[model samples]
Target chain A: MRNTIGEVAKKFNLNISTLRYYDKEGLIPNLEKNESGIRIFDEEAVSALIAIECLKKSGMSIKDIKTFIDWCQEGDETLKERLEMFLARREALQSQIKELESTLNYIEYKVEYYTKAVTDGTEKMVKETMSNPRLLNLQ
Target chain B: MRNTIGEVAKKFNLNISTLRYYDKEGLIPNLEKNESGIRIFDEEAVSALIAIECLKKSGMSIKDIKTFIDWCQEGDETLKERLEMFLARREALQSQIKELESTLNYIEYKVEYYTKAVTDGTEKMVKETMSNPRLLNLQ
Candidate 1:
């Protein structure tokens, strides 16, 4: 049996409004409407939604995702293009992971700095200071 | 000698507007203005900017960063709070990295799927199909 939009949203852990927005954006090409105009999701629609969510998580823009869906509709003819898109997204994700790791390193350093400051009962001795400490005193 | 806003922005790879916004947000507490009202960054201001940028990179919100700046102004009395903030930020960053890595894995799976499809000149055999293939035929 086909699932209602709400059912699909619950199954996928997505918001109903987000599913509606996807439909509005024409990303859910296989979505169907019943006699009373209620939205229904068949397997293909759900699969497409799964793919779209994955792409979005990979930081693909809506425009780019729309292009990917269009390519999916075009079938095997766009296989090369789809492959290239995934490759590019992988590179972007790698860069993001690297940058976040660097940020985490700095946060870790700060955590260590504060850990010592807390133990020492003052930041005066542990705090990093300007080369010309008088500049800090100036203001 | 104190550096002008533009000079500091160039050195730090930040936009002048962003530096001004930071000063406006009170993140750069020690920032000074010359007699002509031009912004000048002393060593203390530059150091605070560096810390603010690191916190921003770790995905701390502006309000949280403003609180941190206030805590810094309060000195050693807030060392424990600052430590807890960094600890929380580190956990958040770690979670983000894990999510991105998972996304990357799925993208890699798609890349492999497409690579084979491209080699075979068709997705018919390589494509993932719904258990009930008839659902795909419905739309």
Candidate 2:
């Protein structure tokens, strides 16, 4: 249930340097040191790393993740504040998703218009653009 | 109008090195050269940089953006293929948006659970966890 950093890196397909970077950033807590002064990780450490990866892929910054982990270690006393922080992050992500969706919709519309123009000929495309002032002078 | 790299960098709030980097990466094409071999950017170049910023924020890689620029320069002959590529990119972005949305939902759920636990006291929280067999073991 315990392993060296190298072992965990190999198992998780992460570079050893990334693990070291995370540790330096305070993203990992309760990291133990072996008799040889090497970092030792137990099952709980592995679970924490997995959680860190999840938060990272969800777009959480290392600083914010460090704060979240600190709250986790502090137990139920800080849970309400942690919950508010999590909800704020979730709302931010929701807005980001909405913005991306809107941009994607515009890109899709442009692609469709261009596709039709290429298939039906440039003359028709010009006429369509002329009829729709919004599509005028597209570069 | 024309501006030196330094002037452009100052006006745009970007570093001179970043402009050089963009030029080296082929993100900016056909940059005019002065008699002394210094780069000179016109209004169109500035507009292109703004467009590049828009695409970059939308998560498009510089290489893909270069290809898009190439297609734009080539005109209607490459229009169909360009449209197809844009459509494919749009789909990929839509999928990413969906993944972010799901992650946001999960975070929201966790936030609610933690908020209730923190407000209701740890004893009540432990009692609630007792309903779950895995958490019951901690009791």
**Largest TM-score belongs to which candidate?**
1
Q: Candidate 2, residues B73-120: lDDT per residue as tens digits?
A: 777788787778777877778788877876666666566666667667
Candidate of highest lDDT: 1
lDDT of 1 by residue, A1-139 (tens): 5999889888778899999999999999968898999998987888888778778877889889999999988988999999999999999999989988877877777788888889989987676641223223212
Listed in order, the DockQ scores are 0.53, 0.38
Clashing pairs for predicted structure model 1, backbone only = none
Candidate 1 segments exceeding 4 Å error: A128-139, B128-139
What's model 1's lDDT at A128? 61
The docking category that best describes candidate 1 is medium
lDDT of 2 at A75: 75
- In angstroms, give how far residue A137 of model 2 lies from its true place: 17
lDDT of each: 0.82, 0.74
TM-score of each predicted structure versus truth: 0.86, 0.69
Q: Please tell me which predicted candidate would have the highest DockQ against the true structure.
A: 1
